[model samples]
Target: MDHTPLRIAIIGGGVSGLSLAYYLQKFGSEAARQIEITLFERKSSLGGNAETVWVDLGNRRLPGKPGTPYRRWADLGVNDVNLATSPHLRTLLAEIGELERLKPLENTASYFSRDGSVALTDDRELFRGASDPSHELSLADGGRLAVLIALLHRSAIDLVESRRITPRYTVDDFFDACAAAPAEMLSAAANALNVDIDWEDPALPERLERLRHTVYYPRISAMYFTDDRGPGGMPLQAPFEYYRLQEGGSPPDRRYFEHGVQHWLEALAAHITGPLKQGPRVEILRGIEVEARLSTQGVTLTERAPGERRWEADLLIMATHAEDALPLLTFGDGLSETQRELQHILGKVRYTRSFGVCHTSATRLPPNPNLWRTRNIEIRGREDTFHPYRIDYVVNRHQNDAETPCYDRAGLPQFFVSLVDDLNRIPRSEMLDRHASPPDAPASLAGAALGAAGYRDRLPAIESALEAKAWTLFKHNVLDAECLEAQAEIERYNQRTARRRYEGHRGVCPLLFAGGWTRGAGLQEQCLKQSAHLVALLLAAPERRLNPLRLAASGGQARQRHSQASGFAPLPASL
Candidate 1:
């Protein structure tokens, strides 16, 4: 084996690993030279949870002889890619020429409750589309909500008075403020937190008040669907705030390959392993157990892939979720006491499970341009229920043509609904052994009195309901079970414990963990930024022995270009 060339092995070919590979190939000098890179994925395909399915319109022949085939992407996990985390994602999209295919789901409607009521949550719709006078508000409700919002904003401002703002406030404290303050006041506080509120006038207090009323408060409790129980639940604060802040725009001006995200990822993999000379899907070891070790070469990974074969890597870049990574790492393995202590702290990170139901049919819903729905009912033991949180539905507009309103496509409504659930209360053991478990582990009956903080007591019921409903809906449409499971695994990996383990090997390992799980920020943009930062660090490493002449020449050119552009004269040739 050639020791002169650096051998890099990236475990888990998910978004994080793939993005890192992309950046490394584009930026690393020796990436094509001395650097030997190999990406290992347990699954046959890449893209991890970013999987898409194609629904055959021809199969469900409608009134029209042959309908066009359209591809449906399962955002089984992530839907909204926040722009704040990584601007490079936009650049990546542009480079791939698929930026135009990126369409922002219409931000018009949100589910207020499980009963399927729609609310105009978007600012444009709230201001112009509100039909009911009460929903629109008559100066009085707006005024009251406004006054409350102002006070809440003032309190938040006071909390950070003269000090750096930090995410130090507990979720309880934040919810208490919302619950105690007037609806309008809560709205104002929401606006301060980046919730968009549309006001016609720039300065009028009344207009401002109307905007405040539109600020949907976060449900402090857990949320569940009365119609169908599920394995997953979500925090009221995250989804509510997310929906309230979600913005939309026309589709990007690029073309999607039409196959799905998997297709694109396959193309990326080909570019890396084929043209880039990196090994592609070298080997997939399914039930391989991993444990941490240390040697003179630095941190070592003891991996038992499928069979009796055991392998070791000088540096292992784990792109798996935190939960999956947890079983691979141990605190006793050459870890410092401080590292062990930090692991304890990181283990506290938690996760919530969520489910999605995608429906495609020959008929469509009414042509309500701004159709939206938000969760309304607040389930006991689960507080966070309502708009921008828990579950959301999206109706694709591009499928409909000029004569047909987006919602009125041959009377067939194709909608995707997401249902969020809590998993903290439910034990993993119970889930794996639901049949053999005790009576307490069984599903709860409908309308059963679920005591406060009794999520464990209610797990079986929720899980049962989720399975039944999911299967029923999925049977009618195409199902993406593997993608859904991958998404769940990703969520489990985001827990605090997983974070501690990864952070523990921070400086010691050449393998850097950069992903949504590592940072607990699951947005695509964040992943891109982390990838770029990691690539830059790897490229600048002095130990790599990159040519100094190349560096100086590049620097000289940069200076020359800067001087010429700034209209400065060349440096004098003085001795």
Candidate 2:
């Protein structure tokens, strides 16, 4: 009933942080105005992983302005989206009403490494690690793999709902569970998804499950994780998609922003904060490091930028890696036992380094440019050998005639290559000399490696290129080993205290976690889900009452708010 505005602070300007801020400000009724939010991002620009850069791919200036320079845009960070699987993300896109921005491109049937040497498209060597005899990574099983993939997706969704929310439900857990499930369950999952079950073959479930582990998981990881390795990450494998064939949903479809994925972030920000001319009503502070002092009076954040000062808020939402957030907290007396323990658990999430290169000079593509004008290559490494190169995939951005119906022809632009390197095994310490030269120097090394592997016909015209984007990224957040342990610890602690939300020694923590890695099956969908889950928690709070009563009139708990966001229809009553 009290109408005093509630001030809140959000750390990290990533999708999780941005979406949380956006929804809190757009809480749909009178309460929306009563909330004031300030977002702080340490980065120089907004749109964390969705970064866009404008550079020349060697096109001439316009006729009118002969001397004027022209620049083409290239995505420096996360650019792919699966329209088939990410419902919650779709809801966000729908709310933004930018369906046109997400246009489909011709999906590549095969993936290869540089010069098409280690052709993952159909290479048996790709499945060198799979212990199972049947789960070979051949490209020909595409049709069967498609059906099995759908079942595996359903299994993850079903298992999460069926099993208790516990740390034991790792991706590995789901893999083995599906592989060992009762024939009836597997049969039904396949049949419901309209994938005809071979009634005579009782081993169908085991077959599908093996393929899921050997093929499906690794493929999905490629789309997100820089390199699927280390203790907590998915095993290194290729990117896979099969859910597209599931029942009546859209075909195997992946869509990217017609302009750039960055546009979505801009639009979301505009919707929440308003246009730039009027200034952001929802104040955003960039390139600022913040120190937090948390207590009942809300969060008092000290910003170190321009000048150092304190800004207080009623709540703090950490939408970044938990480790980045831990130092900011001013823990009094071991930060209190509960807070210390929380910090310890969060600190365990592991991360790895990733490197990439973007170049306008790459002249040659793989042999089948006729089949794939703009192909993406996922290099397959032998289980015994570690390829120190960061070459994850090579994408020709400018020549996507398959996916986009109508696009401008930027002269001789068919060679815009985007390359990724997740394995940071080759540290900068060893490559200082190459680094001293233009970034193109090290990038050229990638070409040589590909040619040596016997994938390319000839050397690229330009061997060197710009090291456009590189960062220390790991597999998705909470899914990793340390975070899972931490998550389990938090859940156990909550169970002992009989508290549903995060409440430490003094009242509740009032600090919620949101990100792709924080909740449910990790991905952009999880990012959206975590946002909705946090928003629902806020609404349910007696102090915050984030939104009106109708927020929970449908879903029984705050978690269901995620399902609620996957719009256009109500979830089943039982769900």
- What TM-score number comes out for model 1? 0.57
List, residue by residue over 1-575, the lDDT tens digit for candidate 1. 33465545566666777877776665556432355455656544454445333222223336757864332333323333422222465556665554554543322332133232323232222222344433221222544433434344333333433244333343334445444433443354444444444333334354333332333232222122111222122222222222111221121111122233444555555555554353322333322345555432444555554443445554455665544455665433344552454344335443343433334321122133334322222222233233222433343432212223432444443444343443322333222111111233212111111111111222345555343221111100001122223334433433332343334434343334554444323445445555655554455433234343234334433532332222201110000
Q: What are the per-model numbers of colliding residue pairs? A: 49, 13
Error of 2 at 396 (Å): 4.7
Q: CA lDDT of each candidate?
A: 0.37, 0.47
- For model 1, the local distance difference test gives 0.37
Predicted structure 1: clash tally: 49
Against the hidden reference, what TM-scores do the models get?
A: 0.57, 0.67
For candidate 1, the per-residue lDDT at 125 reads 24
Off by over 4 Å in 2: 1-3, 28-33, 61-70, 83-91, 94-97, 113-221, 226-248, 275-281, 333-335, 360-379, 385-399, 402-408, 415-419, 422-478, 485-507, 541-575
